[model samples]
Target: MSQFNLTINQKKYDVDVDPQMPLLWVIRDIIGLTGTKYGCGIAQCGACTIHFDGKAMRSCVLPISNVGDAKITTIEGLSDDGSHPTQVAWKEMDVPQCGYCQAGQIMAAVDLINKKPNPSDEDIHRGMTNVCRCGTYNRIKSAIKLAAEGGKS
Candidate 1:
């Protein structure tokens, strides 16, 4: 086991684990942060999405050794009270259905908006590849739009 120092949600964590262990397990099991879910174990699914130094990353396939000193941000770190624009828009648009994928969705949405402050529908469609089993794509789109507009809608 190797020691890793991770800075998540502005908090520092020192953990001793296998270098090949996926960040998803470290976050959920070791660190006890369950907001980032485990989906397809592989990186294809976005359920394990998190912010890796302000960019969206799939945690399930990312080994702890690959994390290095980059700052990580999970859903729990996005906002203390769920006041983030994307989060607010999510609630206003009632985006989630099963809600299993919402955290990853929101994280991806935040990254999208950060890159394109006013993202076009095409941009959203292209940027948000996160899978939603409940088929809430329309609502997710609406929420993204609202968030792009600073949650005005």
Candidate 2:
């Protein structure tokens, strides 16, 4: 077990884990943060998406060694009161059908809007590709629009 110190959700954590262990395990298992899900373990699914140094990344495939001093932000840390515009827009739109993937989806959407606050429908469709099996694409689009209009965030 290698010792590593990583910051998460604005808190510092020290863990003794295999250097090659994927960060998802460290976050969910060691650090006790489960908002970042483990959907496919492969990076294909966005269920484990989190912000690595304020940038969205697939945590399931991220090696602990690669994280270094980078900051980590999970769904819980997205907002102090869960009132981030995207979260509020998602609630206003009722976007989640099964709710299993909403966390990752919201995280990705926030990143998209951070880069482009006023994303067009096509831009949202192109930028946010985190899958939802319930296929609430239209609502997702609407929520993003609502968020862009200063409706939520």
Candidate 3:
């Protein structure tokens, strides 16, 4: 077991784990942050998405050793009271159905908005590849637009 120091949501965590362990398990099992879900163990599913130094990353396939000193932001760390623009827009747009993938969706949305600021529909379509089983794509798109608009909608 190797020791890793992770900066998550502005908090610091020191954990001793296998170097090859995926960050998903370390965050969910070791650190007890369940907001980042485990959907497909592979990186294809966005359920394990998190902000790795402000970029959206799939934690399920990211080994702890690869994390290094990057800043990690999970859904729980996005905002203390769920007041982030994306979160607010998500609530306003009523974006989740089964809600299993919402956290990753929100994280991805935040990254999209941060990168594009005012993303076009095409940009959104291209950027958000996260799978949603409940077919909430329309709502998710609308919420992304609202968030890009600074939660005006």
Candidate 3: stretches off by over 4 Å: 151-153
lDDT of 1 by residue, 1-153 (tens): 999999999999999999999999999999999999999998887999999999999999999999999999999998899998899999999998889999999999999999998889999999999999999999999999999887331
Q: Which tens-of-lDDT digit does each residue in 15-56 have in candidate 3?
A: 999999999999999999999999999989799999999899
1-153 per-residue lDDT for model 2 (tens digits): 899999999999999999999999999999998888888888877989999988889999999988999999999998888789899999999998988988998889888888888899889989987888899989989988888889334
Clashing pairs in 2: 85-152, 85-153
Candidate 1 accuracy as TM-score: 0.97
Report lDDT (Cα) of residue 151, candidate 2: 38
Q: By TM-score, highest first, what's the ranking?
A: 1, 3, 2
**Model 1 off-target regions past 4 Å?**
151-153
Q: Estimate each model's TM-score.
A: 0.97, 0.95, 0.97
Off by over 4 Å in 2: 151-153
Q: By summed lDDT, which 10 consecutive residues of candidate 1 come out lowest?
A: 144-153
Sequence-dependent TM-score of model 2: 0.95
